[model samples]
Target: MDSISSRIEKVNPSLTLAVTNQAKAMAARGEEVYGLAGGEPELDTPDHIKAAAIVALQEGRTKYTASGGIPELREGLAAKLAADNDLEYEPKQICVTAGAKMACFNAILAVVEEGDEVIIPSPYWVSYPEMVRLAGGTPVIVDTLESDGWKMTPEQFEAAMTPATKMVILNSPSNPTGAVYSEEELRAIGEVALYEDIVILSDEIYEKLVYGETKHVSIASLSQELYDLTITVNGFSKAYSMTGWRLGYTAAPPAIAEAIIKIQSHSVSNATTFAQFGGVAALEGDQTFITDMREEYDGRRQFMLARLQAIHNVRVVEPKGAFYFFVRTGDIGLKSQNLCDKLLSRYKVAAIPGVAFGYDDGIRLSYCTTLDILNEGLTRFEQFCREH
Candidate 1:
C-alpha cells in the first residue's frame, strides 16, 4: 500500500455531506430528521426540461459529443450571457462542464499554478478553500464585515493580494449567506483586480435565484478587459432544478477555456449527453419556472429568517437572494458543531455547523425544502435555542 496523496490528505471530507450523512444514518435507525444541510432544491425538474432529455434519448443523442459541450448548448449559453449580462463571448470561449463545481475547479486549475494564492472571502462556499488547497495553492481568505452585508472591501482585497496572487474567487448570492453584491461594491473589487492583473473567478450560479428585485451584476460585463480576465461560472442547478443533471458552464478567455478542456479530456470526458439537451432547453425554454422558484424561495427566506431572528442571542443576516441563512450563535455560549449536534440528535433537525464555512460560532440552514418542512425545522431549532 502506497501512501495516499498529500493533496487529498490535506482536505477534509465535505462538511455539508458529513452532516447530511449523519442525518441519513439516524433516519435509517428510525429517528425522523429534517435536513437543512443539503443545498439542492426539493422541487422536481419541470416537464419541459425533462421532455428535452427524453427527446434527446429517443433521437439517439446518447453518444459523447464534444468534450467541452454540445455545440448548440455551448452557443446558447454564450448567447444567453451576451444578452443577459452584456458580455460577449464566442462558443470557443465557453466550456460546459459536469457542474458548476467542475467549472470552477477547471478554471482554477487552468489558470493557477501551484503555490499561487486564490483569494476567498470568509464565510465562503464550503468548497473554495478546499479546492484551492487541492490545487496546491494557498487559500488567502479575506473577511467581510457583517456591517457591509458580508461583502469584502477593496482594502481587504488589496491586503490579501501578493506577488504570487493568481485568482480571486467570489460568489454573488453567496451559498451560505445569500448576500448579493451591489454593482458599486463589485466594481470597486474589479478596479483593484484590474490594477493588480489578478484574474477573477466569479461564481454566479445563483444569478437567476435572486429575490426582491435585486439585480446580479457580472464583473465581466463592466469592460472588455475585465471580461478577458474574469471567468464567469454558472449552471442549471440552482435556477432550473437540475442539480442532478450535473450541467455547468463557464465563459472565459479562449485560451483558458481550452486549457480547462484539456483537463476535462482526461477526467470524466464530457457531461451526460441527455443532460446537455435538458440544459439547452433550460437556457432557451420558458423562464417562468425561474420566476416562480424565486418567488417561492423569497417566501421561505422570509419565514426562516424571521423564525431564526426570534431566537435570543442568535445573529442571522436577512438574505437578499439565494435560499440560505448563515446564523451566528456564538452568543449562545456553545461552539457551533456542538450546537448543531445537539439540534440533530436531540431535536432531529440537521444543519451545517458554521465551522464548515470557517465560522465556528454559527450554523447554516437551507430554505430550499418544503415550507411545511422548513417551518417545522425552524420550530425545532427555535426550541433548541430556548432550551440552551
Candidate 2:
C-alpha cells in the first residue's frame, strides 16, 4: 500500500475518546465502570426542537439546501448573535456548519497558511492544536497560571506573539479547565490583537452554560474593530442539549464567510436539513429549559467540587462554567496518563488524561453524569489516590 498523506500523520486521536472507550470495553466484560470523560449533556433534546425537526421532515425538508445554509437559519442566527452577544451581522455573514468543531476548523483553514503561527492557551480543548496542525500552522502554546484562574493575560499573549502569528484561538468556558474570561480580561487581549492585526477565533459554544454570577461575554461584542477581526463560533450542542443534531454556526466578516462557504461547498456542504429547522426552534423557542439545565449543572458542580476537596493532596480550581473540573495530579507523583490509567484499571473510574489536551500535570473529569455515579466514581478515585 502507498503511504498516506503526511498531514494525516500530524493529527492525534482524541484523548477524551480514548478514556471513554476503555471504560466501555471494561463494562462490556462485566466489570463495574463509571465514565466521567464525555463533554455532551446527558439531558434529552427539548420537545419543541424535536417537534420542529419532525414537522420539517413530514413537510419533505430533507433535501439539500444552499451550501451556506437555509436563509431562515442564517437570519435566526444573526438575530440571536445580535440579541445575545451584542454582535451585529447580516444573514450573508453567517454560515451554518456540521458542528461548532467544524466551524472552528473551517475558520482556521480559511485564514491560516503554511508556516503561520496560531496561538492557543494551555489546558485547551483537545482538538485546537491538532486542527491548527492539519491546516499547516504551528501551534504556539501559551501557558495560563493556575493561580490566575487558568486564563491568558495580556502579558502572556504578548510573549506568545511573533511576526509569523496569524490567529489567536480563544475558548471561554474552556473544555478542560472551564475557566471563563472576564470582559476586562478579554478587552485587554483584544487590544493586543488589534495592535498586532491578528484574527481571533472565538469559540463560545458553552456560553449559556455558565453558572451563578459568572456571565458570558463575547469578545467580538466588545468593539466594532474586534468584531471585524473576529469569527464567532457557537452551536446548539451544549445550550440546547442537541449534540446529536450536529448543528452549529459561525458569524464572520463577509470575505471570511465566503471563504468558509467555498470550503463547505466542496466538503460536507450544509448541515443537516431538518436539523437546521430544529436549530431555529432551539433559538426561538422558550428558553426556560436552559435556565433549568443551568441550575442543575450548578448543583452538580458544587457537589463534585466538595467531593474532590475532601480528597487530600489533590488540587482543583473551581470551574466557573462548563461541566468539567481539571484536577492537578502532581502531588500524587504520577503523570496524568498513569494516574488516569490507575483510576480506570484499578478503581473503575474513567477520566481524561491531561496530556491529551496539551497539559501533563492533571486529568479532567466531567460532572455531567448522575450524582450517584459521581459519588461512587469519586469515592473510588479518592481510595486509589490514598492507596498509591
- lDDT score, candidate 2, position 324: 97
| RMSD over all Cα atoms, model 2 | 1.0
RMSD of each: 1.1, 1.0
User: Candidate 1, overall lDDT?
Assistant: 0.89
Candidate 1 ranges with C-alpha deviation above 4 Å: none
Q: Please write out the lDDT profile of model 2 over residues 1-388, one tens digit for every residue.
A: 8598888898998888778888889999999898788789988999999999999999999999998899999999999998998888999889999999999999999999999999999899999999999999999999888999999999999999999999999999898899999999999999999998999999999999898899999999999899889999999999999998888888998899999989988899899999999998998899999999999999989999998998888899999999999998889889999889888888888999999877898999998888888889888888987886
What range of 10 consecutive residues in model 1 has the weakest lDDT sum? 304-313
Off by over 4 Å in 2: none
Tell me each candidate's TM-score. 0.98, 0.98
Scanning candidate 2 in windows of ten residues, the lowest lDDT window is: 14-23
* Best-performing candidate as measured by lDDT: 2
| 1-388 per-residue lDDT for model 1 (tens digits) | 8689979988888889899889989999988898888788888999999999999999999898788899999999888998888888889888889999999998888887889998999899989998899889999988787788888899999998999999999899898899999998888999999998999999999998888878999998988888888999999998998998999988888888889888888898998999999999988899999889888888888888778877887988788878889888888888988999889989999999988888787789998998887888988888888888
- lDDT value, residue 180 of candidate 2: 95
